[model samples]
Target: MRLQLNSSSHTPLYLQLEAALRERLASGEWRSGQALPPERELAQQLGVSRITLRRALERLEDEGLLIRRQGSGTYVSQRVEQTLTALTGFSQDMAARGLRASSRWLQRGIFRATPEEALAFGLSPTAEVSRLERLRLTEDEPMALELAALPVRYLPDPQAVGDSLYAYLDLHGLRPVRALQRLRAVAALPRVAELLAIRPGDPVLYIERLSYLPDGSVLEFTRSHYRGDRYDFVAELKGGK
Candidate 1:
C-alpha cells in the first residue's frame, strides 16, 4: 500500500499514521486476518521511526481493529456488532447474524446464593440457586465467557440445560419478559485471558444482567465477559426533532 506522510502538517506523525492505516482498513485495502507488513520494513518504507509506527499500531490493537500474536505477526481483526436495545441470548444474537452459536459448559450445579447474588436476585441469604458457567462461541470462535444463576424454583434440573438456556426456559414456560443490563470495560484477568485466548490486561466488555418475568419476579442473573477485539455494542438515542 502507498501511504503519504505530510511532514509539513502540524499533526503528530503517529496520529497521522494511525488515521491513514484506519482509512486503509475502512476502504477494504486489507481484509480481516490478513497479516500486516513487518515492523522494520514498513517503518523504513514510511520513513518513520519504529517507535512512531509501533505506537500507531498499538492504538489499533487496543481498539480491536488488529491483533498481534507473540511470535506470529499482526493481522486485521474480525469483529461482530451487537445492539444494546434488544434483550436476547447469545444463541439468538448469533443466529440473527447468520452465525452458528455453541457453548462449552464449564460448571453447572445447585449452590447456595452468595451475598451479591442474593441481593441482585432478591433471594434470602440461605436460598439455593442453580449456577451455570459456560464459554460461549460463534462459528466455533471463542466470544464470551458467561456465568448465569437462576432460582432453583425455575431451573430445578441443571443437567437439563442445553445449548440454549433461553430455549430451555421457554420449554418450561419460565422465559423472562424483560431484563436490565449494565456494561463496562475491564482488563481481562489471567484466567479470563486464558479462556478468551487473549493476553492478560487486554480489554474486555464486562456485562451484568438481571431478567424478570411478567409478574416482575427476578428470573435470571447473568455475568458475561466478551472479547473486546471481537465484539462491539451499539446504542441508539433519540432527541427532540
Candidate 2:
C-alpha cells in the first residue's frame, strides 16, 4: 500500500491519518473486510506516535469504517454506507435509513410576542404568538432542542401542529419557499445543558432560521441547539469557472 503522511500542516496528526485512511477507503485503495497495517509499525513509518495512530483508528472505528478485533487486529468495516443529500430533514432523513425518530413536545403555549418575533413575522409587538418547544430525538438519542415562535394571528391554533412544523405549514398553505439560516457555536446554557445532558460550558451548535412563504410572509421563527457530537454540517462549493 502507498502511504502518504504530512506533518507540516496545521491539521493534527490524528486527523491527518484519519483523513488519509478515509481517502483510501473512498478511492477503493483499501477493500472492505480487509485488514489495515498494524499500529506500532505503521506509526513509525508515518512518523507519528502510536497514540496518534490509535486516535485515528478510534475515529474510524467510531464512524463504523473500521472494525477492531481484540486478538485479530483492525480491519476495514463492510457495514458503513450511506447516501448523503442536501435538503434533508431529521425525520425524513433518519426514517429513510430505517432509523426511528421521535419528538418530545416540551411546551405549547401562547404568549405576548417579543419585538424580534414581531419583526420576523411582520406582526405588531402587541400580537400574541403560539410558541412551540421540542426536544428532537433520533433512535432515542438526543439530537436537537427546538424553540419556535409563530404569530397567532396567522396560526391561531397550536394543537393543529403535527409532528413536523414544515408539514403543518404546507397543509395551511404556508409552505416555505426559502429559508435563511445563521449558524454559530455557543456555550451551552444551563437549561440547554440539563435538557441535552451535557455540561453547561460544552460547545453546542446554535442555529437561527427564518422560513418564508412564497407570499413573502414569514412562516416561522425557530432557534435550535444541536448536539455537536452527533452532527457535522457540510457545505459544498461550486466554483464559478
Candidate 3:
C-alpha cells in the first residue's frame, strides 16, 4: 500500500493514518476478508511508529471496518447492511442488492399449531397450520435460517409454497400489509452454527415477526436467525420538531 502521510500538517499522525487506510479500503485496495500487512511491516512501510499504526487500526476495528484475530492478522470485514424501516421478504431484499436469492427447503407440511402459533394466528390449538423451514441464501452464501407458520386457512397447501413465502401469499390475496418485529442477539447453537458455517458460540441475530393482513388477521409468524458477522441492521431515527 502506497500511503502518503504529512507530518508537517496540523492533523495528528494517527488520524492521518486512519484516513489513508479508510481511503484505500473504500477504493478496494484490499478486498473483503483479505488480511492486512503485519503491524511492524506496515508501520515501517508507512514510516510511522507502530503505536501510531496500532491506534489507527484500533479505530477501524471499533468501527467494524476491520477485524483482528488473536493469532491471525487484521482483515477486512464482510458485513452487509439491512435497513429496518422497510417491510420486505428475503428475496426482495437480496434482489435490491443485485444478488440472487435462493432457499433450501428443510421442512414443509401441515402440523398442529403450538400454543404460541395459535395465539398469534387466532386459531385453536388443535387447528392445523402450514409450516415451512428453510435455509435462505444470497449469491449462494448462507444468510439466514427461517421457520414460518401460517394458519391453514391462509396457506392450505404448504407444498405449493415457493422460495418466497410473501410472494405466494400475495398471489392468494393473503399478503401481510404490515408486521410487528422484534430482534435480539444470541449465541449460535451447534446445529444453527453448523448450517450457517460459523462457530458455535458466535453471535447471531434472532428475529421474530408477526405479520398481519389489512383486515387485521395475522398472516404469518416467522422466526429467523441471521449470521451476525455478515449482517448489520440499521434503524433511522427522527429528531423532535
Global lDDT scores for all candidate models: 0.90, 0.77, 0.88
Per TM-score, the best of the predicted structures is 1
Model 3 lDDT at residue 158: 96
Tell me how far the alpha carbon of residue 95 in candidate 3 is from the true structure, in angstroms, after superposition.
0.3
Error of 1 at 209 (Å): 0.5
TM-score of each: 0.79, 0.65, 0.74
| Candidate 2 residue lDDT tens string, 1-241 | 4346666879887898888878878798787667878888777776778998899999988665776778889987643222322433456666765767788999988988889888888788788899999998765657789999987865788878777776677677776677788889999999998887667877888988887767878878999998775566766667998
Ranking of all candidate structures by their lDDT, best first:
1, 3, 2
Count steric clashes of candidate 2: 0
Model 1, span 1-241: residue lDDT tens: 4467887899988999999989988998888668888999888877888999999999998888888888978888867789989888899998998888899999999999999899988889999999999999876768999999999999999999999999999999988999999999999999999999888999999999999999999999999999988998999989997
Q: lDDT by residue for model 3 over 71-120, one digit each (tens)? A: 97998876667898888899988888776889999999999888989888
**Segments in model 3 whose C-alpha atoms lie over 4 Å from true places:** 2-78
